[model samples]
Target chain A: MSPIATAALAKTAPPAPPRRRARSGPPTRRLMAPATLFLLAWMIVPLAMTLYYSVRHYNLMMPELRNFVGATNYKLLLTDPTFWHSLVNTLVLVMACLAITVALGLGLALLFNRTFPGRGVARTLAISPFFVMPVVTGLIWKNMLFHPVYGLLAWLARELGLAPFDWLAQQPMLSIVIMIAWEWTPFALLILLTGLQSLPEDQIEAARLDGAGRWQEFRHIVVPHLGQVLYVVVMLESIFFLTSFAEIYATTSGGPGTATTNLPYYIYQNAFFQYDIGLSSAAAVGAVVLANVFSFFLIRFVAGNLNAGSAR
Target chain B: MAIVELKNVVKNYGGRKAQGPNAVDDFNLTTRDGEFVVLVGPSGCGKTTTMRMIAGLEDLSAGSIRIGGRDVSDVAPRDRDIAMVFQSYALYPHMTVFGNMAFALRLKKLPQAEIEKRVREAARMLDIEHLLERKPRALSGGQRQRVALGRAIVRQPQVFLMDEPLSNLDAKLRVETRAQIIKLHRSLGVTTFYVTHDQVEAMTMGQRIVVMLDGNVQQIATPHELYAQPVNTFVAGFIGTPSMNFLPATVGDDARSLQGEGYRFRAGDARAAGLAGKAGATVLVGVRPEHLKWCGSGDAQAANHLAGKVDVVEPLGSTTMVQVDVGGQRITAQLDSAIAVEMGQPIALTCAADVLHLFDAQTGQALGLPAQA
Candidate 1:
C-alpha cells in the first residue's frame, strides 16, 4: 500500500494494544544494532588509524624511527610547496569538472526530456559513460583520442591540415579534467533527467497559460523545481571529484612537474613512493577535514530547506 | 471578457496516421462573453483534451479556435491571452505566494507597483493575503491551491481555463473551493472553460455543462436540462449519483404502456409519443433512484409500479436508499428516512410518468422525449 493510504488507515484504525507496543519495543533496538555497530567501526576505525599515524614519526623506509612526532609531520606537510600546489590542483580539477559536467548534463537532460525517435536507446547510450571504469575511461581517452600520433583527435587534426598535438604532455591538467568530466557527466545527467521527469506537466501547462514562453517556463518552473535535485547532484559530484585519482594515475600519473597531482595523488606519493607514512597520514587527515568542511555547509543548506518545508 | 469558440476542434495522439481514432473528435462549441462553461465526462472522455485545445496547450488536429472572433489556431500558448489553474496546484515551490501571483504580470513587464496592487487584490479575494511572504512549500494544500488561483486571477487574462483544480483537495475543502471559483467567475466574468470528471462539480459550477463520452459530445445543457432530459442513456447514467437505472422492456400492443420481466407500467402520453408505430419494439426504461419511491399498495401513482424484494437498505439521515431485486434486474429506490424497510421484504416502487425516460435499446438514445421539454 502507498504511504498516504497507510497513514489514512492508521488514522481510522483503532490504536494498538499496550502488549503489542511492548512486544515491538525491544526487537526494534535489537534489529538496529548490527547496522549501528557496522557504521561505527566502518567510519571510526580508519579515522582513528589516520589520527594515530599523523602524530607518530613513522616512516616505512626506516622502521626503527617510529616515535611520537607530536605535530611535526603536520607542520612539515602544511608548509610544503608541493602540498599547496596539489591543493590548488585538486580544487581546480574538482571545480572545473563540476562546472563542465553540470552545464552539459543540464543541457542533455533538457534535450532528453522531450519525446523524440529512439529516445530510450539514446538515453541508454548517453548514460553508458557513467558505468565505464575510471581507469578504462582514462586509457580510452589517452590512447584513442589524445595521443599525438595514433589518436582520433590527432587524425582529425592532420585531416584538417593542423599539427598533431600531444594532449597529455602539453595539457596534463586539462586532459585529466576532460577525462573525468566525460565519465561523470553521465552521473549528473541521470540525476538531472530523473529530476526533469518528476517535474509536473501541469506546472508547465500552467506557466504556458500564464503567458510564459519556452524560455520563461524553463527559467521559472523547470529551474526552481530542479533546485533540490541539482543540490544533491553537486554535493555528490563534488565529493567524488575531490577524491578523483584513477584517471590521473592511468594517464598523467601526476606528471609534468606536479601539474595534475591532486591531494589524493599527493597522499599516494608520500605514502607509497616516498614511504613516509606519517606525512601522508597527515595529508589524508587534511583531505578529510576539507571534505567535512564542504559537507558541513551543504548539509546545513539542505537541512535549512527541509525545516522551511510545508507544515502547519 | 471574450467569447471563446471552438470550431470543429479535434485531437489525436496517433503520429503519421491522420485517420486514427481521435482523443477529442470534432468538438464544437461557442461560449457567450464571460460565460462559465464546464466540460465533464469520465476519464479519457476528451473533456481535458478539449480544454487544453482552448488553452493552446494541445495542438488541434483539425479546425480552429477563436477568442472574441480572432483565430488562435497558430498562436502560441503564451500569446493566447489565457490563464489556467491545475489540479496539482502547480505553484512554483521556490516562490512566495506574492511572487507566484505576480509572476505573469512581471513577465508582461508590468510596472512593479501595478504588479503589487494586482497581486494583493487577488490575494485578498482568495483570502491568502497574509500568506504572501510564505513559499508554497510552507503552505497547506488548500493555501497552495489558493495561491494557484490567485496566480491566475492576477493575470486577468481574456480566458480562464481550469482543469480539475479542486481534485487535489479534501472533500470539504473541494466544496469550499468550488463555491469560491463560482464566486470568482461571477465577479471577474472571464470566459471560462473548466474541465472535470466529476458530474457534481459540473452541475454545481457550470452555467452550461458539456457532457462528453468517447471523445464525442453527448449533450450541452444546463444542470436542470441535463438531469431532466439527457439526450442518451450515457448522459442520463453519467449525470446522476447512483446513476439512472436501465431495464429492458417492450412497448405494449396498445403502445401506451411498457412490459418488462415480472412487471408492467403505463408509458405516459408524452413518453409514449415516439413509440407510436413501434408496438413490439424492445426499449430501455430509465428512472433515477430519487424518482423511484418506495410505495405501499393503493398509492396515488398506482399506474406505474414495480414489485421487488428489498435486498439492501441504506438509511441516510434525510433519506433511505434501498436496492431491490425485481425478477432478474436490480433497481434502487430513494425513500423518506422515516419509512422503515427490511432486507428480503417484498416492496413496491412507483415512479411518476413525467419522470420516466424511454430509450432505444440498441442505440442507447433517448426516445419519446421532446427536445425543448
Candidate 2:
C-alpha cells in the first residue's frame, strides 16, 4: 500500500478509540509466585520424605543406622498377610458404606423434597449428622449406642426379654461401616436434595400430564435428572470414604486381630505401635498409588457418562 | 371435540383462610365445541389460574367445571384427556423429538407400530419430521415450538390448553407461528382455551375474548364487539392500541350541551342518546384516536373539534400518532402521515356528532356508544 492510501484509510477509520493499557502478565505472575511456591513445598516435602524413608530402613529405635534397601520394604509389605487382610477389609468397608449412604440418602432426599408441616425442622434434623465431628460420632456410637453390656442396644435387648449381644466384637467391620455411613448420609442428602429441587417444575408437570404415575416419573425423569448429581456425590463420598481414619481410630483402633484395620489404620499401626518406619512408609506409598488409580478411573467414567448424557 | 364450561370457579393460594386475597373469584364461562376462547389480562390477574382450572390442574374452591356435560372439577389433569402447551415448551431435554411427542402414547401402552405411525403423522403435520431424532436441547426455539405442538396434537385430546406458548419467540417468529397455530386449530377443530397477556393475541386468535382484571371477568365478547362497543372503561381502554382517550366531562344542567375538560359541544354537535336523562351528572368521554380527524378545509366539522398543540409526532409508516395537549388534559390523535404535521403545530381535530362515548364517572359503565344505530 502507498503512504497516501494508508493516510486516507487512517483518517476515514475514525482514529480507533484510545485503548486503555491492560495490566501485563509479569506483575500477576509475581503476585502469585509466593503462594504457589509455598503450596508446592507443602505438598512435595512430605511426599519426598515418605519416598526417601520407604527406600531406607530408618527406625526411631535405632536412628544411628540407616541404609537403603532397594525394594525390600515394598516386597515385605506386599507379602505380609496382615497387609492383604487390611486391604480386603478396606474394600469391604468402602463398598458397604457407599451402598448404605447412597441408597438411604436417596430415599431420605425424596421424602424431604415434599412439602409438609414441620418439614423444615425435619430436614434440619436429618442433616445434623453431617455436622457432627467424626470423633464425636465414633464415640457416641461406641460408648453410648454400641456398648456390649450397658449401651442403648443392650438396654433395649434386656427390656425386650433377650440377651444382650456384643455388637462391636462380633461385627467390627460392620460397626465401623454403619458409623461412617451415618455420618456421610447427610452429606449425600444435602447434595441430592439440591439436585432434586433444581429439577424443572415444567418437566415434572409435563410428565404428570403425559399420564405418568409417581413411580414412572421417578424412574424416567427424576432419576435421569439426578444422575450427574448422584455421580458427583458418589465420587466425592468415595474419595472421602477411602481415606476414613478417625472413626476407626476412636472406636476399633485395629482391634480384634486387625478386623477393622483399613490401609490408613494399618499404616498408623506399623509406624506408631510396631515402630517399623520403613514398612509404614511403604504402605503409605501403596495407598497413595491405589487412590490415584481409583481417581483416574472414576474421572474417566464420569467424563464418559457426561458425554453420553449430552450427546443425544 | 368437547365443550368446556367453568361455573363460578374460585382459587385461593396457600390456604382458604390465608390473609391474602383469592387469586380467582367466582369466574364463569362456557365454550362450545371447537370454540376458541382466550382469557386475557395483565399479569397476576388470575388468567393463568382460570385456564389451569379448566385443564383440571387446579381444583376449584367453590364451583364446578364440566366438560361435555360431565362434572370434572375433581378430576385429574391426565384423566381429563387434555393437552397443554406451556410457555417454556417443557420438552424433555434428554429425549428426542419423537420420544417427547410419543411419550403419552407410550404411557397408554399403545402398540409400537401405532405409536410410530401417530408420532410420524403428527411430526409431518408440524413439518418437523427431519428433526424427530434431535433432542430438544439441540433444536432451535421455533423447532422446539413445533415439537411441543406435535406432542399435543398426537394425543388427539378433547381440549387444548395453551398458556402463553408464543410469548418466548421474537416478534416475526411469533407472528408466523401464530398464523400456523390458527391454521392448525382450524384443521383440528378442538376446543381450545388459551391464556395470554397480549391483547393483540386475544383479538386476533380467539373467537371470543374474556377480559379480566383483579380476578373478575370484565367482559366476554367477540373481538368486533369488544373493539366497537366496550361495556366499561377498563375494556374500552384495554382493547385498542394508541388506547382510547378519556376526558372528564359533565352533562350541562340545561341538558343540551356536554361540558368537558377543554371544549363544550352543543346539542346539535354531540349526540349521546343513552345519556339523555343524566343531566348535570359527571361522565367520562372516550374517543378512539382514529375517530379524531384533522380539520383541514373551510368546510371542516368545527362544532366538535378539539384544539391543542402537538407535543410529539410519532411516525408509524402508514400513519402517524400526535400527542396533543388540550387545556390540562393530554390525548393522542392518530392521523394520516400524508397530512403534514410537525412538533408544536397547533391544530384542531373534529369528527361527526355521533363519534363520542359517554361513561358514568364513578361506575365506569358505558352510557352510550358512538355511532350506534
Candidate 3:
C-alpha cells in the first residue's frame, strides 16, 4: 500500500493493539519507562507550579500578604478589558496571515513550477526568508522598511511624489501581518510546489489530448491535487500563529495604546510590569485551554480528510 | 475516418550537429482510412516518437504532417482532434467512469444530452456500463483498461493513438483485451496508429507493421511477408517465434552449394540465382525452425542434410523443441512430440531448398528475396 493509504487507514483503525500479541513478547513498557519518566517530570512540573500559582494571591511586590485566592485571579483576568482586546488581536493577526500566505503561497508555487534560466537560484532565494531568525526579521521590517522617515517604502513614496506614510503608527496590526506572511509564505510554497511536481506527467498529456486548455487543466487537476497540503499548511501555521510573541515584542512593544498586544504579550505585561504573578499564570492556563480547543478542530479536520482519502 | 500522413518527419534533440543522433530521423508513413498500423521495435527505436508526432504531442524538427488531409504540423494537440491512450492509462483518479469519458465532449461544448449519449454508448461497447459511477481508484486493472479505451472512443476524434496501452495488463488479460480492441476498431472504423515492441501483438493486431531499429525503419510489410521474406537479418531474428536460425557459410563457385564448419546444404537454381553475383563471397543461410525435418542417421551425409547431437528437448505435449549442438554453434528445431528425441542423441536434419533464405554475410541484407509485388 502507498504511505498515504497506510496513514489514512491507520486513522480508521482502532488504537488498541492486540493484547495477546503484545503480552507474548518482552514487556514493551520497559523500553518506554525512561522516556516516560523524563517527560512526566518535564511537563508535569511546570504545569503543577502554574496550577499552584493560578489559585493563590501571589504578588512579588507584596509577598507578605499572599494567601489562598480561590478563583479571585481568574475572575480578575477574565473581567479585564485589556485581556479581551489582546484576545481579538491574536485572532485577527492569525487569520489575516493565514489567508494571505496560503493564497499567495499557492500562486508563488505555481510560478516556480515552470522551468527557467535561474529556477534553482530563484527557489533558493524564495525560501531564504523562512530561515531568518524571528528577531532579525522583526528588526529588519521595523527599521529598514516600515520606518516612516527614511525607510525603503518612504524613499519609494518620495520618488512617486506621494507623501511618506507611517506604517507602524497608522496600521500596526497590518504591519505585523505582512511581516509574518513574508517569513512564512515560503514554507507554504515549499510544500505546495512539491505536491504540484509529484503529479504524474502523463495525466496532463491525457488532458491536453481530451481538449482541455491551460486554465481548465489547472482548475480541475492542479487545485484538487494540492488539497491535502493546503489543509496541513493551515493547521500547522494556525498552531504557530496563535502564540505569536517575538515579532510583536521586537517591533511594536505592545504599541502606542495596546493596538498590537496579543495574548502572550498581554500576559508578559501582567507578570513583570504589574508583578501580578497569579493573574499571569491564570492567563497562561487560559492560553493552553484555547490551544487545546483549536487542536481539537484541526485533528478532526485532518481525520476527515484521511477518512475520505481511504474511501477512495 | 482518417489518414495520417507523416512526410519525412524529423525530431532532433538540442539541434542536429551536422551528424548528431536523432531521436527520430526522417520517418515517413501514410495510413489509409480505417487502417490499423502498428510501429514495433526494441526500446529507443523511436516508435513512440513517431506516434507522438502524429498526435502533435512532440514537435517535428522538420517536415510536415497531414491528418485527414489538413496540415496539422503547426496545430496544438487539442486542435488536431486526436485522442491518445497512454501506456500508464492516465485516467483522472478523482473522476468517475462517466466523468472521464464525458470530459472530452464537454470540452467541445457539446450538449449535456449528447455527451451522456456518447458516454453511455462507449461504456456499453466496452462492457463498462456498470462501472460508470466508480472512480479509477476503485476499479480493477482490467476495468481501468476499459475505461481508458472508452475515454478515447467517446471522443470520436479524427485519429486514435495508443502508446502500448495494454502493456500494463497481466498476460491473460492482455490476450483477451486484444480481441476486444480489434472488434472495437472494426465497429468504429477509425484510423489508428498503435505502438508496441512485442512481435506477437504486431503480427496479430496490425494490418501492416513498421519494424524499426535505432531511429530508422527496418521494414514495413504485412506479417506474413515479414515472416517468410525478411529484408534483412534483424527482421528475420526479430519476427518469428523461436526466431530464424542463421548459419555462416561460403557460397561455392557453382552458386548452388554452401559449406560451413559442420553443416552442408544445397540451394537449387530458383533460390541460388539471386545469389549468383556473390558466388565467391561468404553468406548466411537462414532457416525457420518449422522448416527443419528429422531424417535417419544413415542418410545424414546426404547433400541436403546437416548432422548434430541433441542438447536439450522441451516437450509441449503436441510438439517439442530440440536444441542441437553442431560443431560449436547451437541450432533449435521444432519436431512432433511423437518423434521422442532424447538429449545427447545424434540427430540428422534436412530441409527443402525452397525454405532456405540467403543473405550477404557482411551487410546482413537478404540475397534471395523475390521483388516486392
Candidate 4:
C-alpha cells in the first residue's frame, strides 16, 4: 500500500513486447495463386459469357443470325406462363422436400440415437439411400415402387383390397417430392445425429432434476443446443435442392402438364430441345439470382439461430 | 426438510443377474432431518454413484431409498423432489442466469411473480444478480458455479444432491465457495448430500462425513472424530495431510511394549490393556507426523525413542518436516522449525505412548479402542 513499494514494483515491471508480423504471408499466397486463378477463370469467365449470350438473340440452329437484343430474353422469360409454372413448381419442391426431410430426419435421428442390439448396422442401412445416385434413386422409385400395376406399392394396395393408384400420372409433383425426400433425408439424419451425440449427458440429467418432462427437455435444451447445427443443415440442403435435376429427369421427365417441371428442366428444354441458347442462358442467370435471393433471406432469418448460444 | 435413508443400496454397471461386481455394494446411510452429509472418496469409489442413486438418477439393483419415510425407489428423479448440482456446473448454455434459476419453478407452473421473486432472492444470495441476463458461456467459472448454486437454491426442494460441484473451481474459489455452501446450508437447513474426492472439503463442510473406498463405506463420523479416532488405517492415513506413518513392529513378550526396527516403546495403559493377550503379535505402529519430536541423539538403545538418518528436510513457515530413513524404511516427522537439521545426519525422535496407533499388520484394522471412544 506504500508509494515507495508501488514505485519499486513499477520500476521492476518488464516492458510489453511488440507485435510481430506473420512470416509466411507472401510465399503462401504465391503458392496458392495457381488454384485461385484457375477457379476465377473457370467460374467467372463462364458466368460472364452466359450474361453476354443472355442479352443477344442467338439461336443454335441459326448460327449466322446473331443480333443484340437487350432485355428481350428476360422479358420473355418473365412473361412466359410455362416459365412461371416451372418456377412455382421449383419453389414447392424445395419447400416440401425440406419439410419432409427435416421432420423425418429428426424423428429417425432421435430414435436411432439410443443404443440397441444392431445400431451400427441400422445406422449404416438408414443412410444408404444418400449414397444411391440421384438417377438410380429415380429409377428405383419409378420401376419398383411406384408403378401402378406392377410396382411394390401397387401390389401392396391390390393385396389389401384397395384400388391401385398411379403416382407419376396422377400426382407427379408429389412423386418427385417423395423421391427427393427419400434420398436427402439420410443426409439430414447423419448431420443431425452427430449434433445430438455432442449434447452433454449431464445437461439432460440436470433437466430431469429440474423437473422438466421429455417435451420440455426437447424444447428448452436439446432443440436450442442443436440450433446452429440445424441452420447449417437447412442452408446446405437448400442449395442442393434448388439445383435438383437428375431425379425429375429420370422419373416424371417434367410431365403431367409441367406439374413437376422445375427451373433446371425448363432451361434444359429451352437449350437442348428448342435450341434457343439465348433463352436458356437468361433462365440460367435467373436461376442464379433466385438462388442468391433465397440464400440471402435464409441467412437473414435464421442467422439469429447461429448467435443463440454465443457468449457476449 | 426431510430425513433421507438408503437401505442396502446396490448398483452394478453390469446388467442385473450377471454376477459381476457392483459399482456400489450394500451401501446404507440414514441422515438426520436437514443434515448436511458429505460422501468423500477417491475416483471410481462410487461416491457419486451413491449420491445419484439417492437423487434417483441411478437405479438401485436390490434395495430402496426413502425420503421423508416414503420409499422413492420407483419414483422419477423429478418426482422425488431433489435438485442436483453437477461437477461441470451443467447450466443450460442457451439460458440466461435468470432462466436457469427460474427453470424448476416454471416447470411447476408457479405464479410468474413468485418465480421472479424466488429467482431474484436466490441470485442476490449468490451475488450473481447483475448476471441474470447473461448466458452461462458469458460467465467466468466462478460465476457459472454461483449460477449452478443459485439454480439449486431457488428450487427450495426437500433435498439437494451435489456431485463434486466444487471440483471444477480454482483453489481459492473452491475454498470460498466451500464456505459459501456451508453458510447456505446453515440458513436454508435443507437435507443435502454432497460428493467430493477432496478430504479437506469433506472435513470442512459436512456435518457427517462418509468415507468410502472401492464401493465400500470405510467410516462415517464427524470431522473431529474422523481426525482423532479414525476407524482404520485407511481413514487415519486419508484424513490427514502427509498422512499417518506406518512402521512395522512386533508386540513385546511382556505385552506392554512395542518394538520396531530401531526403537522400543512401552504402550500406554489403554493400549496395553487392548494388547493384553497379543504378545509377540505383528502390528503396525502408526504415528502422526506432528506427534513425533526430536530428542538429543545421545542413547541409541534408550526406551521410547527412534534413531534414523535424515533423508530430506522441508522447512515450512511454522513447522519443519523431516523425512528420515530408519532400518531401510522412510518416515516423516513434523518437527519445530527452530530445530536445524540436514540430510544424511542421524537424529533421534520420541513420542508419548498415547499418541501411538497400533493396527494389525495383515488386516490393516486398528488394534485398540478408538481414541475418542
Candidate 5:
C-alpha cells in the first residue's frame, strides 16, 4: 500500500522494542514556568479579582460578608439616570471633539503644505500642542486662558469694556471640549500632514495639465489621499476622548453638577470617591465595549474605502 | 493648430555660485504649426527644463513664450493649452483609463456626451479602447504610456510636450511605441516638442532635431544634416553611434596628414579651403568608422591612407569593427564582415578626404566643410 508500510515490512523484527527518543532540551514545565508565573501574577490575577468584585456586593464600607449578586451591578449601572447622562455627555464630547479636531487639523495641514514664509516655524508651533502634557493643557486652558475674571479672555473682555462671563460654570462641557480639542488637534495635524506630504506630486501636476482647477484637484486628489489618514486620526481621537479622565479631573473636576461627567470620570467617581468597586468595574467593562464598537465601525469604513480605491 | 515660440527664456536656480550650472540659459526655439521638433542631449543639458518652461510648469526667469501668437509667459499651465506626457506617464493612480483621458474635459465641465466622444476618439487613435475600463496601475507599461498619450490627445492642445516618454519601456517596447508615437504625431498634426537623450529617437522621430549641450543649443537641423555635418566636435561625438574618431594631425603646405607612430594620411584638397592659412598647425581629424575602408580591399595608394596594426576585432553579422593601433593611438574602422583581418595583423585603412572632418585642436571647433547638399 503506502511507502511507510513497505519500509516497516522490510525492517527485520527486533528482539527489544526500538528505543524511544527523549526530548533533549528543557522540559515543558521549565519552558512555560516563567510565562505562566507572569500571566498568573499580572493578567489572570487582576482579571479574576475584577470578576470577583464585579459579581459581589462589594464596597469599602461593607467588606465583612461579600454576597453574590449576579448582574445586579450591571443592572444598576444600566438603569442609573446619572450613568446614562454621563454616557450621553461622553458621546457628545467625543463627537464634538473629533469633528472640531479633524476639521482644524486638516485645515492646518493644508495650510502648512504650501511653501510660505515662516513655514518651518509655523509647522513646529502647530505640532507643539501634541507634546504638551494633557494635564498641563487643561490647566493652561482652565486657569490662564478661559478663567472668567483674570484669564486672557476676561482681560480682553475687560479691555473691550464687555462683561466677563464664567466659562466653566456657564458651559462646562464646552469648556472641556475646547480644551481637549486644543490638545488633540496637533495629533490629527501630524498624521494628516504626513499624508498630504506623501501624496504623489506628479499626479497633481498631471491634473493641472489636464485643466483641473484648484477645487477639482482638492476633491479628486488631495481629499481621496487624505481619507485613510483622516480615519486613523478620528479613530485614535475617539478612543482617547472616550477614556479621557485626567483632563476633566484636572480642569473641571466633573463640576457644574455632572455637566462634564463622562463615562471615565463616572467610573473614577464610583471606584475612588464612592468606593463602589463592583459598579465601577461594570462601568469600565461597558466603556471598553463601547470603544471597541466605535473602533470596529471606523476600521471597517477605512478598510472598505481602501479596498474600493485600490480596486479602481 | 498653433506655432510655439520661446523668446529668450532663462531659468536660474538662485543659490551659491558653485551649486551647479544654470538649469537653462537664455533658450530660444520656434516651432511652426504642425512641426515635430525633438530636443536631445545628455541628462542635465536643460532639454527637459526648456520643455517644462514651454508647458508653463516652470516660470521663465526672463522670457516670453507664445502659443498661437499669444504671449503665454505668465499664463497658468492649464490655460496655455499645452499637454505634456511625462516620463513617468504621470497617470492618475485612482482613475480608470477612460477617466484619465476624460479628466480635463470633465474639469472643464463638458457635457457627458461630448466628453465621451472626445475620449473615445482619442482612445481609438492610440489603440487603447479595449483598456479604457482598466485603471492605470493594472495596465502594462506600454499600455499606460498609450493612455498618457491618449489623455493628451483628448485635450487637443496646441502643442504636445513629451519628456522622454519612451525611456521607461523595454528595448523592444520602446521601438514599437516610438513608431506609434511618431504615427500618432503625424495623424494628430499637432506641433509636438519631444525631449530625449536617445539620439536614435531624435534622429528617427523629429522633423528637426535640436542638439543641446551645457544649457546651450549647439545646432538645430534635420537628422541628416546633424549626422552629416555637426557644427562642432561635441555634436559630432554626441550624435552618432560609435561616434566619429578624432586623431591629432598636422597640416602642411601642400597636403595635410595625421602623423602617428607608424601612420600618416594625406588630407586632400576637399578640406583645403578651411585649412588654407593653417599650415603646420595641430588639428584633429575626425573619421566616421563606416567611412574608413581596409587598404587592400579598396585602393591602397589613396591620398588618405594610414597603416596600422589591428589590435581588436568585433564582428557583427554584417560588418566588423576593427580597432587599429595607429602610431600608438587606437582608431576604429568599420569593414565588411568578409574581410579576413585578424588581430595583431598589420593593415592599412583609407578614408575619403571629402568624408574627413578636420577640427582645430585648441578650440575643438570643426575646421572644414559647408553644409552637406
Candidate 6:
C-alpha cells in the first residue's frame, strides 16, 4: 500500500538473509580417520613397497644392482616346473583338507547337538585341538606320531607285523594335509555346533508336526539354517590354511623335493634360502590377491544368506 | 474327525526329594469328535503338559492316549495325525507362507500342483492369500499366527491342538482373533483341544471347559454349568470373576439352618433334605457376589441376612462392587449401577437360600451334589 509502511514492514521482517548454518560436520571423516591412518601406515605402505620390489631386479645377494625388471619374476615363476608342481600340490592339499574337515565337523556338530550322558565333557574335548598352537600341533604329529621308526604310526605298523614306512618321504603332502585338517577341524566344529545349537527349536517341532522324517529335517531345515555360519567357518579356515607355513616348516620343511612347497613356503624359500627379495615380494603379492578373490566370493555368499534369512 | 481319549494319564517331573506333588497326576479326558474343549488353569497346573502328551510331543509316564479308537502311546508326533499351533506361532523363518503350509505335503512327496492347491485353499480360508509369497518375518504377528493356522489347516489332521495361541496378541487383537478361531472351529467341525490360563477365553471359546488346579481336574462342564454349579470349593472360588465368597458356618437343627457370626440362614426344603443330619459340623456357605442384595428392611421372606457397614464402593460403569465389613469378616457384593450407595453406610444384605452352595469344610467337597450329576 504505502511506501513508508512497506519500508517499515521490510525493516521489521529481517536484515540481509542469514547464512545457512552447516548441518553438523562431515560424518565420514569423523568416523573413518583412525582406520584410514592405520591402513595407510601398516597395510598400504608395505603393500606399495612389495608392489615396487616385485617389478624391480633387487636381490639381497646383489644389493648394489637394482633395475626395472617388468614382471620378469612372474615369468620365471610361471615357467619353472618346480613352482608349477608345488602349486598343484598346494591346491590338492587345500581342497582335500577342507573337504575332510567340513564333513567331520558337521558330523560332530550334529552328534553334540543331542542330549547325551557326557555331552558337556565330549564337547570340551572336541574343541581342545583348536586351542593348541600351530607349531606344537605340527611337532606332535611329526615327531611323536608320524616319525619313521619311533612315532606311533611306525610303532603300530611294527606291532601289526608290517614294515615301518617313511611317512614324510613317501607322502609328504598328504601327511601335511592330514595334520592341518586335524588341527583345524575343531575350529569348524565349534562354529557349526554353535549354529546348530542356536537353531530355533520351534521350527524343528513344526517340521516334525509336518511329518518330516529325521533325514528330511536335516536336509531341509538344519542345513539351510547353517548356511551362513558354515560360510564364515570356511572363509576363516581358508585364510589360515593359505598362510600355513609353521606346520610345513616344522614337519616337512617343503621337503623331499618341491613336493610340499605351497605359496607361503615358496615365498619363504625365495627370501631366506635363495636370498631373492624380488621373487619373494612377487609371490607374496600374488598370495594376497588370491586370498582376496577367495574372500570376495565367501563374503558375497554370506551376505546373500543373511539377506535371505532377514527377509523371512 | 477323531475323538481323543487320555485314560488315567500321569506325568511326573521326578520330584527332588521323592515327596513333591506330581506335575500331572491321574489326568483323564475324553474329547468327542467335532467338539471344542478347553483346558484352563493357572501356571504350573500341567495343562500344557497334558496337551503335549496328547500330541505325542511328551511321553506319558502312565496310562494311554487313543486317537480315533487306536492307541497312540508309542507313536511318534509325526504319526499321530495331530497338528498343533504353538503360542509363539512357530512358523519356519526360512520358508515362505506357502512353503510353511505345504511342507508336510512336500515331505510326503506330493505333486507340486497338489501341494499348491492345498496351500492356496488353506490360505484362502485364513484370508491370508496375499501373504503366501512372503516369509514370516515380513508379516505382522497376527498375520504370522494366521499363517501358522493355515499350516495346521492344510494338514487336515484328525485333531487340532493349540497351546495359548492367542496369548501373544494384544488384548483387542486377541479378542478379535479369538472370535475368528471359534468361528473357524465351528465351520471345520474337527475335534479341537485348546489350552489357556485365561478363564475368560476358556469360558467363551470352549464347548466344555476343564478347570484344573495343582495338576488335578477340579471340574469339567459347560460354561453355564461351571458358573451355576461348581463341583467343589476350589472350582467355586476359581470359575467366577471376584469368585464365590466362602464364609464358615455351622449346620444345626437337622441341617435346616446355618449359623455364622452375626448371621443365621434357614435352608429351604430342597436343600434341607439334601443336607439333613449334619448338625455341629463345619461347612462353607458359598454365595456369589452378584447374588447378594441389600435387604433394605426386615422381612420374613429373606432366608439369609447379615448386618454390615460398607467400607468401599467401586463403580464399574455397568455395575458397582461394594465391599462391606460384617462381623470381623469382609464380603463383597455386586449391585446395579443405578444404586447410589455411599461408603461408610450401614446396610443389611440377604442371600436366597437356594443359591447358597454348601461344601464340607474338611473334605472341600460339595455336600449334596452327586458325582456326574
Model 1's CAPRI class?
Answer: acceptable
Q: For each candidate, report its DockQ versus the true two-chain complex.
A: 0.46, 0.44, 0.42, 0.48, 0.43, 0.40
Top candidate (TM-score): 4
Instruction: Put down candidate 2 lDDT per residue, B1-373, tens digits, no spaces.
Output: 9988889888888566644777888888889899999999999899999988877767787889999888989888778888999999999887889889988998899999999999999998889999998989999998998899999999999999999999999999999989988999999999998999999999999998999998889888899989978889999999989799998777877665677766665443344565688898777878899988888756344667677788989999899999998877889988988988989888788766666766789999887555543
Clashes of each: 1, 0, 0, 0, 1, 1
Question: Which regions in candidate 1 have their CA more than 4 angstroms from the true location?
Answer: A1-24, A27-33, A293-312, B293-296, B299-302, B338-341, B371-373
What is the Å distance of residue B91 in model 1 from its true position? 1.8
Pairs with steric clashes in candidate 5: B261-B327
lDDT of 4 by residue, A1-312 (tens): 899999999899996564444464457888999999999999999999999999999999999979999999999999999999999998999989999999999999999999999999999999999999999999999999999977999999999999999999999999999999999999999999999999999999999999999998888888888888788889999999999999999998899778889999999999999999999999999999999998899888777655653321
Question: In DockQ, how does model 4 score against the reference complex?
Answer: 0.48
Off by over 4 Å in 5: A1-53, A65-67, A299-312, B15-21, B255-262, B265-270, B297-299, B371-373
So what's the TM-score on candidate 2?
0.91
Measured over all alpha carbons after superposition, the RMSD of each candidate to the real structure, in angstroms, is 6.0, 4.9, 7.8, 6.2, 7.1, 6.8
After TM-score superposition, the amount by which residue B69's alpha carbon in candidate 5 deviates from its true location, in angstroms, is 1.1
Q: Over the true interface residues, superposed, what is the Cα RMSD of model 1?
A: 3.8
What TM-score against the true fold does each predicted structure earn?
Answer: 0.90, 0.91, 0.90, 0.94, 0.89, 0.90
Model 5, CA-based lDDT: 0.86
By DockQ: ranked, best first: 4, 1, 2, 5, 3, 6
For all candidates in order, state the fraction of native interface contacts they contain: 0.84, 0.53, 0.74, 0.77, 0.63, 0.65
The segments of candidate 6 whose C-alpha lies over 4 angstroms from its true place after superposition are A1-40, A67-70, A298-312, B15-20, B262-274, B295-301
Candidate 6 TM-score, true structure as reference: 0.90
TM-score of chain A in every predicted structure: 0.89, 0.88, 0.84, 0.89, 0.83, 0.85
Q: Give the true-structure RMSD of model 3.
A: 7.8
Runs of candidate 2 exceeding 4 Å displacement: A1-35, A296-312, B18-20, B252-257, B264-271, B297-303, B353-355, B369-373
By the TM-score metric, which is better: model 1 or model 4?
4
Against the native chain B, each candidate's TM-score is 0.97, 0.94, 0.97, 0.96, 0.95, 0.94
lDDT of each: 0.89, 0.86, 0.89, 0.90, 0.86, 0.86
Residue-level lDDT tens digits of model 3 in B95-165: 77888888889889999999999999999999999999988999999899999999999999888899998
lDDT of 6 by residue, B63-120 (tens): 8999999999999999999899999988887778887888888778889899889999
